[model samples]
Target: MVDSESVKSSYPKSITTSAQDDRGSMEKKQSVQQRVDSFESGEVETVIDKNIEKSALKKMDLVISPIIGFLYLMAFLDRSNIGNASVAGMSDSLKLYNERFNVAISIFYVLYILVETPSVILVKYVRPSRMLAFISLAWSIVVLSSGFVSSYGGLIITRLILGLLEGCLFPALSLYLTTVYSREEQCQRLSYLFCASGLAGAFGGLFAYALEQVHVGNMAGWQWIYIVEGLISFIGVPLSLFLLPDNIEKSWFLNPQERQVARLRNEANLRYLGQQKFDWQEVRKSFKDPKIYVSAVSQFCADMVLYGFSSFLPTIVKDLGFTGLQSNYMTIPVYVSGVLAFLVVAYASDRTKIRSPFLISASLVSAVGYVILIASNSNAAKFTACFIVAIGCYIGPGMNLGWLNNNVAGHYKRATAIGIQQTIANSSGIIAGQIYQSKSAPRYILGHSFTLGCVLVGLIGYIVLLFSLRYANNKRDERCARGMFDPTLTGDYADDFRYFL
Candidate 1:
């Protein structure tokens, strides 16, 4: 919601006159028509009081957050459900030889990388309401199809299609939310959304366990898990359509003045990014931008390690001499601990408005945890170490993603960045799957080493981020002395435009 009564400042009147004269002296006659004056009240303020709004833009988040969350939770749950089923004897039941299950999980990332950018752009063009709803239904259908897959080829087909549908999800949700909230509010929204993944991880085990109790008519527990989760995803289609407001200003519930403020703010962002259409410029610019690349590559490595461990942990637990039921139950504490870490990181990032430090610390902690795992043989010790690894890795990508969002200039660039980030980062999925094949079960020597390497990449990426921040801050100082906009800046403060550490 926008605050209508906020005061706007542009230095003092004399300074504004001097700046105008200086601009004229530079032959840069940047004058606007009289119509521009309609929104340009000299007394307009920067602060938008949160108490003044009564729009669904205000109420919509509560409804949309859980809906989008539920959709993705199920998407990810079904994608990784094979993890649960692996221990439940999906391998034996289907006679999948030579760790094809790992390969199937890796294949999802291929489609994930391919479809992500286009899907997000589609969301921006077509509107999130329809875009997310359609994707929800599609992924639900794909997830449901997994239940009937009896052969490895069938499972692979389902995973590929599931990836294609699910790829659109997070980036679309991100672009949709950016239209409604300021950057400061974006992080809390992101955290709440990301916490759903933790919930999915925690609850997927429970869902599988509950379904195991059913064993209805010829279906296995894993099949029931996918079917139930898929059905739950379908429920979001209606919810998203009714909720998620289309184009913030069009919502009549917003006061005219509030609408004016929002429109101006959005226009400013669009100008900064320089497009009313899809901008391929961002792709080239992103390569030059240190934060974008660092965050993407580092996050890729993080996901590689995180997905590797999580996607295979249940099977690994079963191999570690735990029963299928015990393995399912054992995942609860690890995932719950991860949920705590996600919440903690979200709150801390929102409070401090910092990212790389948290990212770096978490990466180092994960490295230590993986190191501990390789050294220890005790089951309790191993569980604790893995729990630490989960906390370290699970909380990272959100902060990194949020960091990129805050720094990138517009909805399109931000959207494109997410696509690239998720795509590049997801390439690690292949490496992750190969690292933890069945041959390495019980004491997965190669898998632990791969995690250690990923943790190192994350740590190095953080270092690069620190240096990038230092360089950018110096450029800001130079801009301040020259009295020119840095061109890269947005939001209300210098620090606000910074990376999310």
Candidate 2:
């Protein structure tokens, strides 16, 4: 009787039953809207019936690219800034008068090579924000510590530490980003990140030029180069902690819907990678895959020329009769040339859905430039050659690495695959550094010759990968035609499973 009386009182005398039901429906709608909003906010990583906003995805890219770019810039700068130092007279001042400079620089690669493949396994387990941000700090310290070297031992030790710390970067980044963004989005994201390396190369030279003018207090120009670049790298560590999100679910900056949108995009990416299960056997299988070997071989070939030229380019410029400041300034144009090359290839590769041909074509073009650089005496010719060389050498990794990404199927495979690619590929740094000694400075014929040979070999290797991928695809197609396999299995297979070619 109290419920009836309360219901009668609560019911408005002016309202009928249908009108009351309308009020209930409106309240229900409001409750549903709240559920949608909660999902959009991504307070939880749960599934719901909601439409993903396309605009939010575009916005997410805007947020993530700069942070990823910073990582790449730092990667390029930390490893190759030593080149700027070489031009600034790192060898002469530190009295690494023997072939110790090459050996010292090469030592970084040993630690780099050892740490590279092993670090990938640890990548998924560690919080990349914590791991790589701390790594950035570690390497920044190593870079700064290089400035304190009064003896050869200190430089070698510092270089090794730099390698040890840097070992976590590119692979960790690839894993983290791919875990969130779709494959279609990956190339452009990767490109922006990689393009920053060219920017670093450009700025690294310019920075070295500015530092050369300030050779004062107790430091040589080269020593100051280390100190300054090291300081510059420190700026990134803090930004990474605050602005960076580890993956989609942890993306605090993104709303729930936006985060789901990110995850949804990568679903195709995941399936293409063969519904990747994170098993050690997959990693072992990745190692055994001949394609991995082929990719690594191609990577190694590319790096021999790339790292060789990078570590020694400044020294080479100095030998051509430019002062330290002049050599540093000269690198600006090369980097500018490389920046354009990276962007063009990146956009075009994604647009045309092509990868290998770009790398092969660029490698050969670069190989031609190396031939002229070694043979030329004209300064104008040499300067123009830098433009060509920059485009070729710098373009290879962005393209080739993207190629590796395109071919790799699962997360574990991609990790081990990229790990092997980097480890073997980076060994070229040792070879490149060793080839161009200061004594051979003005005309390091061997370095030039080796670079040309390696680039050509890389070009050939990419061609081989293309053929191999095509051959595999054909076999699969034939199997489908014979009803040995379901055509449905080939959708992500088509989109997600393209060979590195």
Candidate 3:
């Protein structure tokens, strides 16, 4: 996968100094050694690549993308299956009429929010492979147990634990992928993975349709949904533990020379981020950084639509005069559209090395979809709007994840930032779960209006962020022109580190 010859010819080779610069060369060697030591010790910042081969990257995509995507797919199905279950008699069986179903949905986010940041920070101590396997296994157990929940309290408890176990997964996955790919490369990679949520949506509908027809011993169709999905997740545990590589250095697929080049390229990113050593100061630095908050806020808005729509699409479709099974079948196209749009936008963004334009454009598309739903009574218009919203909401999160990954550097700072963003952003899940109440059924004007406002807020936030980043980069350039920029500066704070627009 690592095409050493092609990469060598495409980029300028590093010059080795002769006997004339023996003293300087010695110092340089020591510095490089220190960097390598730091990397091995888990004290160094992330290494970024200047460029990697298309074929080499494609090889990696084949290995990592599908695995990560499948993981997310399972997570989505487990998390959202309750929605489908509710319509299939879980509500009457569990007596979750009125707002009780909403409460059950909202309660998952309480523990989910609490554990997100800390779990991601914990990944720094534990290897990503081990952490991911453990989380997936634990959560699968919880989800399987949920199938047997006969009481409201039992369901609540299981949902809370499910949230806690799943809290670490997304942020951990994002951080793990960043270790291997450059910023520009991350968009498509993230899309490939995130597109799983869309796939999950489509597959979930099919699973719901298929499972609803089953008559298992002592279990209802709703219970079968949970049991089968949980079992599917359990199958992935062994694969992650045995087959997944933790980082490039340890990958079984790469040769020594490729590893050396990858290390060097990543070292440049380490230099940009400043220090590889763990520092409390780095975590505190993220607290003071405005970019992190902006990204988090933008994520918050985007996820409102994502969580709300994914969880409630079946209910909404059922309101359009379809039977329970028919509603599940109808949801396939919305998710399919979303997956297509996400892949296209991610590819374009990566090729152009830009995010804001696509993000803003997609958000506007979602906003218009919301407007259509709100303004129209026609069934065709509403269904078309569903597809538009699905397409639009799915694009922002992947781009924003890449945005933070590219701009934020340092181990603790980046980890903490990701955790914080996920925590704050996912809090929208609570709000989304509660927004589309049964009382507002059929039209759901209030729910549609609320999401419309959310996307607009996200659009405005990205626009401001784009200009502010440009201004910051300009100021850094001005300092460099005056010879006042720090030679030691690296990563995004460095005068030379350009933000991915």
lDDT of 1 by residue, 144-180 (tens): 7787788888888888888888778877877666666
In Å, residue 170's CA in model 2 sits off its true spot by 1.9
lDDT of 2 by residue, 366-460 (tens): 98788888999776676677678888876787668777776666677778888888888888877877787766766667888888888888888
Model 3, residue 82: displacement in angstroms?
Answer: 0.8
TM-score of structure candidate 1 = 0.84
The runs of at least 3 residues in candidate 2 whose Cα sits more than 4 Å from the true structure, single-residue gaps closed, are: 1-54, 86-93, 212-222, 273-277, 315-321, 486-500
Which residue segments of model 3 deviate by more than 4 Å? Answer: 1-52, 272-276, 487-490
User: Per-model C-alpha lDDT, please?
Assistant: 0.68, 0.69, 0.78
Q: Give the distance in Å from residue 80's predicted Cα in candidate 2 to where it truly belongs.
A: 3.0
Best first by lDDT, ranked? 3, 2, 1
| Two-way lDDT contest, 2 vs 3, winner | 3
Q: Report each candidate's C-alpha RMSD, comma-separated, in the order given.
A: 5.4, 12.1, 5.6
Could you give the candidate ranking by TM-score, starting with the highest?
A: 3, 1, 2
